[model samples]
Target chain A: MTTVIRELGDEQRELVLNMGPHHPSTHGVLRFVLHTDGEVMRKAVPEIGYLHRGLEKIAESTTYPGYVPYTDRVNYLEAMFANEAFSKAIESLSDIEVPERAQYLRAIAGELNRIASHNITIGCITMDLGAITPFVHLLRERETINDLIEALCGQRVTHHYVRIGGVAYDADDNWLKQVEKFLNHFEAIIEELDNLIVYNEILVKRMADVAVITADDAVGFGLVGPNLRASGVDWDLRRDMPYGIYPKLDFDVPIGAGEKGTVGDCFDRFVVRVRELKQSCRIIRQCINNIPDGDIIGNVSRKIKPPKGEVYSCVEGARGELGVYVVSDGTEKPYRVKWRSGSFSAMSIIEHISEGLMIADLVAVIATLDVIAPETDR
Target chain B: MTSEALIDYVKGLLGDKTKWADPEAGDNFLTVASEDWKNICQTLATDKKCSLTYLRNFTGTDYPEDDEIELTAHTFSYSEKHGLIIKTRISREAAVCDTLSKIWPAAIWYEREIFDLLGVSFNNHPDLRRILMPEDWVGHPLRKDYKQQETYRGIPTTRPA
Candidate 1:
């Protein structure tokens, strides 16, 4: 923690600085109003909603199946998780049964998306900390994941692949072979990222002991995913509340051990994401090896109207627990839809923790949180 | 604890304050009066039997037919491994309720968002302002009767037919 400096008279007047809405490091259209006394920040107020698209309002008008494409736009980086969460909500409401092979396919797509998202998180964090080489290297590896996803689904970024009953399409033998080939070399790529950036002394010194969040504060502020795990709270929605084929697969949830500094600092958050990349790879390998042979889509009605009921379903997204709450009116269109995004809660805690930190370190904290603006403001 | 036991425990605590409890719903839905919203939330967050510390999601639903706006909050307890959906209905004319930002800081943003899009107000909120829309926006867009403006500062606001 940085010490607050106080001086008398006109020389010590507090300065107000606006940090984004167009700044490159913000990753999107996010603005922070900082009230600083010299180098130490007195208060940092986050002004979000610049990228708000009224996705919830849009969901009310679109039918259950028609809204699947819009779900991809909610979180562009990890669209599969968003797609799965929305689809699962519909499935629970209508009591639709998904095929076993489709569950495995969805898990494989989700893990691949998780790896791609983590690559961006690590790359952006390192690049923000003044290391440019690792970011390019990580993105180069991400290209391979993108290629694999493109082979399965037509689109690369927003793959609206998860349908209500199952996935949009089945992966052919060629697609499965390409996934196996990518997994064979993925472990070494994670190790290369570890050596190139994670172990670098400058990166550790810059991130360690910065923006520490205790376990109590993490829960009180509703922090989820890596941010909450980094605070040393052993909670992951995928492990605790098993969904789809995640219960069948075996993997470990990494928690912050405070190796570089105290628990829940920037370093632990960065390291947790790095470790998760390996876990995602392990899940992917298991899913690909044991994928069953059956029909991809289940027997669902063409009308796509759910009974008059409300359901809330969540999946462990790239950022955290992405939940979808849908209220149906026994009609073609939904009555109400609310998206509980992980980034929204992650961004809410920044105002409390940003006080008493240097302005430059604020960027590091934001990067480590890995909040996508569209998800937060959606 | 199971969701049924959790709801029973909350029912015992709230007594008359608990308007309705449906454990069979997707997420155990519990409705309470708007007056007891703050205290009930405080008890839910702090009580050992039902310590729902995690505020997962919060939003408002508009029901013009009922002439009320329903504010719903989804809370989960990591220690207990249970969840409950708490809701309160207030008349649209006076859509004000007590703020839970003190109990869970995450509610501040949700309350602001509801206030922004649905026109719900939270009393004693530290910063109760529009979140998703600009401060000077004309109407709450999520309401059933909300109409789009033709223009904003001389620029066409609607899509061309």
Candidate 2:
């Protein structure tokens, strides 16, 4: 690694700088060896694996149903998506039919989790830019959603809500009422947040036209969710692939329109996430009103030993496409389990995009992409 | 194109170089030899009808019982909204295959990860190193026959059961 960095540095008299295996702005336990000639970076080589816990290896030893809680640890910010993806994989392997009401409940939980996740991404972008006030306001709104999720799943962060065939718990009338109320109130909160910091001059100046990723590059690098959409790609797994109750829900997939600057820039990524928060609220509102009364879990067997086969199931996670590839060998435990996370792919693109970018703008790019360390390392 | 038609199209393009797995099962893929892996991927990426621009998921699985390791690349087309899975296997003794990083930039890290955990090496990959594990880590941990090291740089890796 040193030889490679020296080879790149020898071209010009460059200063080598090490930024965090512990830097707050690097997101989590990520280190970048930067080759910079005083503030402009020639290359930023990201060094990862600080948070890798061998979740895939552990899955080979754990029972099919016992691995649900571990998926929560994959991406704690959007634990519902991880849980749903794993559950869908198992269901697909076994050909278990999830109850209609359970599908609606899973969608509701997932959207609420999406809103909570976007709150952190938008808040952290502003916070990383030195505007601390917006983070406080966003966290306040996130707390209400977290409290609502706690009520729904009986756990706060790592809610193991989705089971193999269906969901673990069902939503009652009172919980639905609270979710509706929160969506009604969150609509205005988003407007307030936009006014407070999203449209602030300093934030826009720091973010707009910085680290622009073109549409073709985005597709080639396999950017998903908001990052891909910000690059002007019209694709969303929920809409294009149509999983669960997303096909039944009526909502719009908001793409980057370059409202503030050039398309696929940092500002566009930030704005696309902000718009997604509203869209998530819209989807949750629809789910709340249209939830039906039925069984939450299906008639799944006690021993979940699916026939020998393999399946790849994914969900539109908070960050992007969170996928689980399961290869079962007619056993109670999974033969092999591989996670395809969005952050891992997003992190790989940093070396390509970080060329010629200022040190501070790199922070903006990482924050705007919302690359969570656990998801990337997992 | 649908999964069936996609398999047929790829079979027609690659002819004897590829063999299409039965589409009746889950995720039917085209099985190609190790030498033909890069050529088939290049054909898929550049072909006007296929044009699989996005490499959705790329991973490797260890099957020591069969004395072989399988690598799977799941490629998707944004314009057509269709996807195809490609599988290639190499002997466990010689786990080397041609890299697809030239075709899709997304394959760089994915190839490195497969090299890191499953002990598969990609030929001509720009940078192939341990990704999710330490550089000095001993053996591939994802392999079914792997044994955990007692300690790493004086830090114990195992705990009491």
Best by DockQ: 2
TM-scores for chain A, candidates in order?
A: 0.96, 0.97
Query: Model 2, A245-316: lDDT tens per residue?
Result: 999988888898888889999999999999998889889888878888899999898889988878888999
Q: What share of the true interface contacts does candidate 1 keep?
A: 0.67
Error of 1 at A368 (Å): 0.2
Alpha-carbon shift of residue B146 in model 2 (angstroms): 0.2
The DockQ assigned to candidate 2 is 0.72
| Predictions' DockQ, in order | 0.66, 0.72
Model 1 Cα displacement at A140 (Å)?
Answer: 0.8
- Model 1 DockQ (Cα-based): 0.66
